[model samples]
Each structure stands twice: as C-alpha cells, then as structure tokens.
Target: MRGKKGNKEVLKRILLCIRPYTSLVVLSLGLAVITVGLTLYVPILTGNAVDYIAGKGSVDFGMLGKLIVLIIAAITVTAAAQWLMNHVNNMITYRIVQDLRVQAFHHLHRVPAAYVDSHPAGDLISRIITDVEQFSDGLLMGFTQLFTGVLTIAGTIVFMLTIHPLITLVVVVLSPLSFGIAGFISKNTFQMFKKQSETRGELTSLTDEMLGNLKVVEAFGYQEKAQERFEEINERLAGYSLRATFFSSLTNPATRIMYSIIYAGVTLAGCFTVIAGGLTVGRLTSFLSYTNQYTKPFNEITGVITEFQNSLASAARVFRFLDEEPETEDSPDAEELTEIQGKVELEDVAFSYRPDQRFMEHLNLSAQPGQRIAIVGPTGCGKTTLINLLMRFYDVTDGNIYVDGHEIRDITRKSLRSNFGMVLQETWLKNTTIRENIAYGKPDAADEEIIRAAKEAHAHNFIMKLPQQYDTVLGEDGGSLSQGQKQLLCIARVMLDLPPMLILDEATSSIDTMTEIRIQNAFGKMMNGRTSFIVAHRLSTIREADVILVMKDGKIIEKGTHKELLKQNGFYAELYQSQFAPS
Candidate 1:
C-alpha cells in the first residue's frame, strides 16, 4: 500500500515524528503481541476440548476447569492489552497533533509575505485543521493497526503451520488473491482521496472569499452570483467525496468476500482430509479456527491500509505548504540601527507588481529629519506604493532606498521597521476591548498612558460612553465600531508606539469633516518633531505641509510648498484647485 518510494524511508520519517515517544510505541506493540498470543491460544484450547470429548474416558473435570480459567485469563489479559494499546495510541496521536499544529502555525509565520498574500486563508486553515487531523487519524489507528495486524497474521500462520502444515499451505495459497483485490482497491482509493483533498481546498477557498467580501456582494447585489459560485464548488466537492467513499467502502466488502470464499474452500478440503483418514476432528476444527483467525487480521490490515492512504493524501497537502520558501531575512552580518534621526531618501526607485508594468521608476525624493512631507496624487498614481516601499513590503527592482543615511537593505528589517509607526487607510482592530486595542502597539503601556493616547486620537469620549468603557469587547475586526471610531483607534495605537517616523496613509479619509479637523489637530501635535510622510488624495489635508510631492505614474512630477506649487500651475495646482476650490 505504500508508495513506490522506499517504504524504509517513509517509515523512517514517520518514526522520526514519533521518536520522542519510543517507549510508548514499544509498550503498545508488546500489548498487541500479548493480545494476539492470547487470542491464538483460544482455538488451540477448543481443539483440546474436542479431543478429550472424543476419547472414551472420564470427564477430566480438573483439566476442563483449568482450560476455563485459562480462557477467562486470556480474555481479561486481551482486554487489558487492548485498553493499553488504545491509550498509548490516543496519547501518541494527541501529542503528534499538537506538534503538527505548532509546526504548521510556525511555518505559516515563516512563509514569505508574498506567498501568504496570495494564499487563501480558508484553504490554509483547512490544511492546518482538516488535513492535519486526517494525518493524526492515520498515525493513531492506521500505524498501530498496521503493525499489530502484520504481527498477528504472521504469528497466527506460523502456529497454524506448526500444528498442521498441509492446511496452512492451502490457506496461504488463497491469501494472494485476497491481497491482490485489496491492493487494487487501495491504490485506486488513494488516488480518489487525493482528488478529494484538492476539491475540499477549492471549496474552502471559495467560501472564504465570499465570506470575506460579503459586504461587496450585498452592495453590488451579487448575492445570487456568490451563491451560484459557492454551489458549484460544493457540488464538485461532493462528487469527489462520493468517489473516494465508493472506493474506500469497496475494500472491506471485497476483502470479506475473498476471505469467505477461501474459508469455504479450506473447510471442504479439511473435511475431505478427515474423511480420507489423514486428519482428526480436533485438528480439523483447530485448523479451521486458525484460518479464520488469520483472516481477521488480514481484514483489519486492509481497513488500516485504506485509512493510511487517505491520510497520506492529506499529509501531502500539509507538507506541500510547509515546504514553501519562507520570507527572506537579513544576513547575520546585517547592520543594526540603534538610533534613527528619520532622514529618508529614495534614489531612482523603480517598482512593479508585474514586470511589464512599472509603477515607479527613477523616483527620487528626500526628507529631512522632523520635516513634514505630504504626497498628493490622483487615484492609482503610486501614492500607496511609496509608503509600501518605505515599509519594505516589497523590494525595489531598481535603485535603492536610504534611511538616516544608511542603505535600507543593509539594515536589519526589524530595526528598520521599529523606527516608524504607521496608520493606514483601512483600519484593522482585533476582537478586543478599546483599551487593549489602543495598547496593542505598545503592550507595556499603562492604563493612563492608553487613555491619554485615545484622547489624543479623539477616541476616548466614545470609548468611555460604552457600558464597559475601555473593557467592552469588540466584534470580529471591530465590526461593532464605526469607520471613524476604528480609524481613531488605529491612530491611537500608532500614537502609543511613538516611533521617530510616522507614515499616515489616508489616515483621515474615513472621518467626517468635524472629526477630521479634530483628528488633524491631534495628528499635527503627534507629528511635531517627528519625521512624517502623509499620503492623501484630499488636497485640503496637505495645505500646511512643509513640502508637497505630486506623483504621477510613480514619478514625482511636481515638488514645492503649497503657495509655490499653486503658482507653478502644474499637476499639484490642478489637483488642489479641483478638490478644494469653490464649485
């Protein structure tokens, strides 16, 4: 049932996963062996009873009583062994699952930002939860039963042969056919399971996409369209599931039929041998019992194999995700920036989401320490790209960016990012209290400090009005809060961090004019003596900027103060007049 790749290597990898619990594995195996031995003794005892009864002798009550005690002992021992095996198997599975979950989560953290951005959240979650769970099932039941079944089958056959070799020979002859059928079914079942896993991933991805964009679907009146897409994925998943189940279900019945035919044939042959004066009734009875014993393990082995194949399919998906390259990190020799004055420069920076379409090229800009630089541009004019580059969300395809006179790539990413605080266009808040959200950027901030930051961002009044005040729990993504409230909370989070450089990317876009004025005043105070970059489409917001850069096609076409840019009558002047001038 194992793949073409060496079973030794595959087993080695599996063993490595369980190496820490070697003692438990050994104990479970010992229990299984004991249980098998006890089970095998039952039929032999039954044969002995038949021989005693056939003899024209006394009842031999003492011997019968002893056999009875042995039977009870065997049952008790087998039950205890089964319990131990089950316990050990469960413990190992739980530990392996825990380890796997941790590894999956850690791998997710290590994966490249670009990879994560492209991967669907629901599919990834399915791999971690569903796929990993499937693997655990195989590890527990599949692995344990496989090992125990092999030993039981082998031991049962060896003892049966020792007692009656001819009967054992006949039974062994029929076994290959049974194995052939099971093997054929198992191979096909594994293929179906792989397809099933892929379909499930697609289904999860589609559902996640729809749920995440629920607002867009309703606003665009595309509810029926979304439902249709979801239904299509669901139907495909159902089809794959049915195919997998069909193949898997066939294995058991097929094995059972093959074993039943072999049993009938063996019984007829044993009866003929007895009639020919070659075997006694006791021997015939015991041989038939041993034949049945062998089939039980064979049946179990087939079931385990099917389960194992299914788990392998899930394991492949999970392993594929783990194998993906993680985010690149700076070299160990990378320079660390302890103190940053926040002087920033972009020299001939060129970037593109795709190679054919360059967003920014030869984009040169510089900002002095404590300077307030505002970037204004029409929609889709690379305003956000500038902030993204500054944050190193992506690397420049050409030229370099410098901070505090040091090349950015040369500096450690963590240290580079630590020097700046950001408030973005779309605010993201966790499902936590307002106070906790404000304190997130600086986890060690005192309650008073958190309250002060919230007040500065104009979030404190609304927060205090809630019944639980700062302790009230927010819903998922802070759905309970208004857009302005969420943005203010984000700003408050940024303020609490108090980094040397601040980048506000449309920070006031969601708030009303009155709230915007209040937030603007607060932002100006927060920006004092800190190097600041503002990316705004609203011309009125940058009226007081120390310098303005009007970006078009990722290049700065106009650079000047508000009065100078207005006088120049260039792109900046046109945008300003269009947005703020009287209608």
Candidate 2:
C-alpha cells in the first residue's frame, strides 16, 4: 500500500510539473493520434488495393494507381504528423525540465540548514542535474511515443476485429500475457532503478568530496585509501546499474517473445479463416499487418515502461528533495528590528540539536550594550550553538533570546541578523572582486569606505599586491587567496558592516601574531560602542572583555572579567594558563 502511494505521489508530482505545458502536451498527443490514424488507415487502404487487384483477376492499372496515390498521400500525412509530434514533444519535455531545475534550485535555499548540513552537496546537485535531466529524457520518449502507441493499438485492434473476430480474439487473449510480463518486470525494475539512482548519488557525493579535498587527501597521503573508498562505491554503483539494466532490459525481449507467439497464433487462425472463406486472402494480409502493428505498439510500450520506470525513480528522488521542509519563516506579525541597541539576553534557554539529547537546559546569560562578552569553552560545549541561536539560524527549543528586549523570534531573521556582523573562523568568499567581497555586508558601499574597512582589517596591503588589487576576481570561494587573506577579507566585511552587535568566532585564528595584533587593535577601537561576543581559542585576545564566560557541557562554569577569573584561578584561569602557559 505504501509503495502504491509512493508511486502515485511520484506520478502526481511529475504530472504537476508538466501541467503548465498542457497545451503543448495536448497538441503533441493530438498530432500523435493523427499520425497513428493516418498510418493505420494507409495500411487498410493498401489491403483494399490488394483486394481490388485480386478480384479484378489482373492488376487493374488505373484503379491500383489511384489506390497507390491515396496510400502515398496518407503516408505523407502520417509522416508530417509524426515529425510535428516529435518536435512538440521535445519542446514540452525540455521546457518542463528547465522549470523543474529552476524550482529545485530555488527550493534548496528555502530548506532548513539542518537538512543541508546532513545531506551531501553532491547528492543534492546530482538530483538537480543528473536525475532531473534523465527524467526529462525519459519523459520525452514516453510522451512522444505513448500516445501513438495507444492510438495505434486501439485503432489496429478495432480494424482487426472488424476484419476477423476470431483472430482478434486470439490477439486479445495473448496481449494480456505481454502486458503481464511487462508489468511484473516493471515492478521489479522500479526498486532496482531507484536503488541505482541512489547509489549514483552516493558515488557522486564521494567523488565530489574526494575531488574538492584532493589537496588535503594528497597531503595526508590518503590517496590509496580514497581510491579504495571510491572503488567500493563505484563497484556498488556498477552492480546496481547492472541489475537495474538487466531487469529493465527483460521487458522488451520478454514482451516481444510473447508478442511473437501471439502473432503466430493470429496467423494460424487467419489462415484457417481464409481457408473457410470467412476471410479473404487480402483481408488475411491486412489482418497480419494489423496484428504486427498492434503488437508493435506493445513492444514500444514495454520499452517506454522501462524508461518510465527509470524516470519515475529519478522523479521520486527529485520530489523527495523538493518536499524537504523549509526553514520556519517569520510570522506575519513579526516586527522588524529597525534600530538595535546591541543588548542581548538569553532567558532560561534550553536547546539541543537533536530533541532526544538535551545539550543545554535552563541556560541564562545577559550582555549589556557596548559590552565585550567573550565566550570561552572547550570544543563542542554549545559555543557555536549559542551563536547560532543568537543569530536565529536555529531557533531555541524552549527559551527566548531577546535583542534590546525584543524576542529574536518576534523579529524577522533578515532584520535581526542585519543588526549583527559576524566573522566566522571558516571564511567564505564568492568568486568576485576583493572590493565586492569586503562590501558583501553592504553592497552599495563606496570605494573609499571599502578601502578604509580593508585597511582597518589589515587586508588593504594584500589587496594592493594582488593582480587587479581590489578589482581582482577571486576563484571559487577565493581559493586563490591565502587563509589569512580570506579571514582578513571577512573581517573587512564586518568592519564595513559595523553592526550594532558583533560575533567573532576565532576570527583571526589564521593570521600571524603581528597581523592578529593589528586586527585586534582595530577590533578594540570598533568594539568600544558595539556589543561583541568573541569565541576565542587563544586566551590572549580576550583579556579586556567586560565579561568572560567559561563554558563546559553547556553550562557556564565561570563568568567574570578575564583578570577576575585569573585571579580566582578557576576554569577560565586553567584554560588561559593551559593555552599561554607553554608550548
């Protein structure tokens, strides 16, 4: 029952995707029907010509010539309609594919960060590119042929039944066996194809990971292990591909064999009918032609079913991704944070990445306006998670985070986030000019303002040394730049933004001590009037913090000024000592 429902859902989504092109689809189908009708009628006309020649005792040249001309005209019409159908079908199929790709790409942005974090980028990309393209190709073939196949079968059957009911009965009986065989193969193949599609995604993910981190893999001398890992996935993908192909391949031959058997039976029955004078020789010829035409469609349909099964499998994956729940949107009545005071407070904050594991419970903290609150914690102690909650990347499970006394949830995410400038440890830059990278937080920033921010962040020196200076376009996430340079660019962005609040997560961890000192001095000047939360690894950076919260296991074990904590010789003291004590 679940399987049926899933299949129906996949089909429903596919239909919905194609719905916008209904007019073209209808026109394509109409052309197919016209083609099939003309083609079917031509064969009947040819049969009549044969009957005319046979009855006249000799070839009636004039009448035969006229019949031949009529047949030619019908064939010409059929060919024209078939050509038009193919053209229309291709247009409709590719257009639907374009729309689906756009929709899938658009949907990804709306999906929750958790979904993206858990799913591989390569897998999502495969669904959007490979699976969607394959589905479109399959759809094209199915749409192009399915209508003609059905119409030809129905028209051929009707014509055959009219010619000889007994032979048609033989055909009708044997036809079910063909359909039954195709159905059984189709059912088995669907799962295999679906598995193959999934395996392909896995393989793509692994390959993408390996290639994207090839330098790291090579540096670590893990190429052999990576190769083995890729081979394992590749071998499994190949196995699934072979199985899917083998099963789907069974349909055409199996159906064709069944069709041949039916053809033989129909021929025998027709021969008997002709001998009995119930059917003429010309009619037998026509019946044989009709039988092949009828069974030919079944053959085509079996092939279509195989393609359709693959397409359905791919479509299911695409739909599954599309159906992923997006991030919770702000409420309609949510207020915009137009002017923020930089004061933040977390009240009884209880949260966890997973509901089953309660990471933080009854957590409370407060930051006064213009206060530099440094958060010091052991790794995975909900430090970044706290930042995430503060930024509303993930909402609190059972708490309220207030910015200037307004609950973070009550404010629009865009408006709330815009109030804070963040420079994370891991920098991200687009493939664009260094000036644009710095101005990302303020897209309309002036050149002088951008240069001032870069100079303050100590990035202007490197920017001046680059090929095009600030106008240089970076490659793939600014991979062309050094890590410290990237960090400087990010810091420059925050400097340009100069939001009411700041979140720095090891923002200068990549830079040299000299550069870090300069950046810290700049930060000191900037933090004078803005609230700041710094997640520091190097204890030396937060000596002047108004409050230092030492976190462990989601609890703030100690909270005081850095000097106060050191004086007390508690968790913060030990952490600071451990970092700066020795090597």
Candidate 3:
C-alpha cells in the first residue's frame, strides 16, 4: 500500500541504515563528547592562569607554567578528537549512503513491471543517484556538526551552572529564542527545498529524454524547442533554490542577533557579581568565555539548518521510493517446475490495466507440447498483453494460466519465466563484448555456444568483421550497430538460452528480408518440438502457423490453421489478404 512518509519516519529509516554500523556510531559519539568536554574545559584552565598572573614577574611562574601546559594539552586533544570524530562521521555517512543506494537498486527489481513502465526512468535515476548524494551531505553534517554542537552547548551550560547559577539561568532563558528562530526558518525552507528537489528530478528527466532521442530531435530541428523546455525547468528550479536559500539564510543572522543580546546580558550581570564580591575576576573571565561557547553552537546550528533542510528533502524522496509496495510475492507453497514440456493453457482469462475498464475477458487458449501459435491483431488488441500474461509479468484478473498442468500463479515466477525465451521489438544490449551480449540470458554459456547462437541469428559474420570479433565491445544499447544488427543481437541472446517455450513479439521486424529468411529457417529448427507464440504485424511471417488467432478489442474472434482461416474468409483471412493482395 502507498503511504505518505513524514520526516520522523524518514529519519527513522536512516537510523535503521546506520544500525549496521553501530560500532562506528558509538565511536563517533564518544569522540564528540571528548572533543566538546575538553573544548569547554579550556576556558577554565585559561581563567585560572589569568588569576595566577597578577603582574609580569610578580606572577606565580611555577603555577602559570603548569596551567599553560595543561591548556595546550587540552587544546591538542580536542583538535585530535575533533579530527577523529569527523573521520568517523564520514565513514558512517558514506557507508549508510552506500547501503541506501544498493537497497534502492535491488528494490527496483522487486517492484512491479507496471511501476517501472509507468514511471520516468530519469526521475528514478535522480532519486537513486542525485537525491541520495544530497542526503549524504546532510547526513555528514548531521553526524558531525549537529552532534558536536549540541554536546558543546550542553557542556557549556553545565560549566556555567557550576560556576554561577544566576548567569547560567539568564543564558538558558535566552536559548529558546535561538531554537525558535532556527525552527521557524527551517520549517519555511523545508517545503521550498522539497519543491526544488522535485523540479530537479523533472529537469533531469527532460534532459534524459532529449539525449536518448538526440537523433530524432536533430532530425526534426527541435533543438530550439528542447532548449526552451529545459530553460523553463531550469528557471523553476532556480526560483525554488533561491527562495529556500533566502529563508534558511535568515536563521544565521537572526540567531546571531539574539545571541548578541544574551552575551550583553551575561556581561552586565556578570560585572555586577564581580563588583559585589559574589564572583572572582578570574571566574568572571571564565564565565564570559562559557557564555561565548554556549552561544557559538547555536550559530553553527542555524548556519547548517539550510543544508539539513535540503538533505531532509532529498531523504524524503529516497524514502518514498523505498516505501513503494513491491510486486506481490509468490506464496510459500508455490511449486517449482523442474521438467517442463512447453504445454501452455489459458482458461477463461480476464485482464485489464485498470479496474474500471476491462480489456481482455473470457479468453481461452491451449497449446500442445509442440505447436506454433501466431497471434494477429491490430494495435491495442491484447497481442502483447497475452504474452505478458504468459510470462507472469502481470497476473490474470480471473481464471488461471497453466504450464504443463501447473497453474502459473502456483508456480514460482522465476522457474516459469526461465522456461520461456523472449525477444522483443526493442533491442536492449548491454555495453559489453559481443560474446557477453549473446550469452546474457545464459551467462555461463561457453564461447562455442555463444558463437552458435550468433550464427543462428545471422550475426556471426558481421561480428567477426569487428576488431575483436566476439570479444568486440559494444557501445550503449549495442552502439552504432544498425537496427537490423541490434535486433539480431537481441535474437541471439534469446537463442543462446533456447528455453522450453518462446515468445517473439515483432522480433524480426527490424531484420532485412534476406536475414529474416535465414533466421526463420533457424527458428524452424528451434521450434521443432517447443511451444511457440509468435506475435507479428506482417501477415506473411506466420503463414505456416499450425493455428492462427485473430483478435479484436482484446478478444479472439477467429482461430484456425492459416489455410483453414483463409478458407473461412473471416477477420484472419481479411488480414492475410491485406498483406498478400496486390495494391
């Protein structure tokens, strides 16, 4: 179920990410305490040394020497602790961010195909990459400055109280004003930062769209329009960024002004105490130093509030994605198909993308162990949807699909999908060597096996012409390869696996007539005893199918052998005529 996540929940999740690094967290915290404690004690040592130095030579030289050395030692230790603390903070922040990115990536795999299909890839990439990096920045500040600042403030208060309660009371009363200012500004900027984050995601998505389709944009002379669109998004992001910065920036000066009042009040009250003999001059000096130490952290806190707000916004985006409801998992008792014979059946199947609109209904189909079933239909006629159902990418709304007598829902999705080899119209080749692309479906396949698959797909000859033959590295999505070549690589990938069943959805549309003929011959041998479902817009590709199903409006209206359907002169015959008849 989808749910709105609050800041507390998002923070809680971040803490959970940190749970694995408990030792590091504890060490950083300990270092912060040591650093702040020594930092606060330094003023005391300085004040005592001030008391001992009555005049130049009249000063107690021996006592001053010990205080000077002790002060130096404390300062050195504080510096060292602070450094170690920062190093630890970085470790925790980056490690947590690393875990978060890994988890987000793996979560995408479990999410429904519908989610990936419907969402913009660029937006998701931004959340996983850009947003996560922003969160890391915020997290590092939170771990180091936030923690140390709070500790320093607390330690200063303790020292002030031990020395004189009345002055400490004044400082404590003025402290809430600082918190109030920081809180107000942070709250205002939080929404702006969130808006800024979303705008950035939109901008990234637009840029990715333009880059991925650079050829189309250039061909259509749409550079000016694309730039205009980019400028609009970039402008909106700038506005949001400026507004958030302006508001959060106020926290610093405003808090500093309030702190100035606290310093003034402490100085006036502390002077009166020294005059009345209630406080010593040296103690007064130490108390004043404590006052500055006490207020310094508030300044530091407010200064970082802007960065923290941005971090929180980015974190919220990441958490929202991580919180998405993953696809329904298989039941515990889901059976595995160890030995499949390629028989498939759909009984009274009903499906739809939306509940209010039914697309396919009461659909029934059966394929014997070895048969070629060609599906012919116009666009939006459920041709691909049927294949999706068979692959278990989407479950049927009613009835059940069975493979080898086992209900598909009852069988594990992995095993069911593994038994089917699919090649789609859109070719997707990883940026790797030709051998790896061909062996993608079966990664452990031998080089000889990969060569055989490439040969079957009529891709081996062209691959050999490359610099490294099978070892030739391809560029993004098969690089500068022609559409036909790319499609052949995709075909080779599936051929390498050679699963028990096959689904080819316009898989050969990009290949030339000569290559298509050879591939068809290869498929003829491959489909000898395997159940095959071929979805083709070109009527001639499936002329020899044992059965042809003509679909309209998501329902099968005609089914027969190609010759039998031609004899019926029904919808299937009409489609065949449209392709074969003279213009």
- The global C-alpha lDDT for each of the candidates, from Candidate 1 onward, is 0.85, 0.88, 0.90
RMSD to the true structure for each prediction, in A, is 2.5, 2.4, 2.1
Judged by TM-score, which candidate is best?
3
TM-score, candidate 3, is: 0.95
Cα lDDT tens digits, model 2, 349-370, are 9987797999987778899999
Give the clash count for model 2: 0
Who wins the lDDT comparison? 3
Clashes of 1: 0
Question: How many clashing pairs does model 3 include?
Answer: 0
Over 4 Å off in model 2, which ranges? Answer: 52-58, 271-282
Model 1 TM-score (2 dp): 0.93
Backbone Cα, N, C clashes tallied per candidate = 0, 0, 0
Worst 10 residues of 3 by lDDT: 1-10
| TM-score quality measure for candidate 2 | 0.93
lDDT of 3 by residue, 1-583 (tens): 1123477777687788889999999999999999999998999998888888744458898999999999999999999999999999999999999999999999999898888888888999999999999999888888888889999888998999999999899999989998988988988898999999999999999998998999999999999999999999999999999999899889888998998999999999999998998988889999999999889988888867778878888988998899898988999999988778988999999998898999999899999988999999999999999999999888898989999999998999999999998889988989999888888878899988998888888899999899999998999888889999999888888888788899989988998899989999988988889999999998888999988889999999999898898899888888778888999
**Clashing residue pairs found in predicted model 2:** none
TM-scores, all candidates, are 0.93, 0.93, 0.95
lDDT of 2 at 324: 88
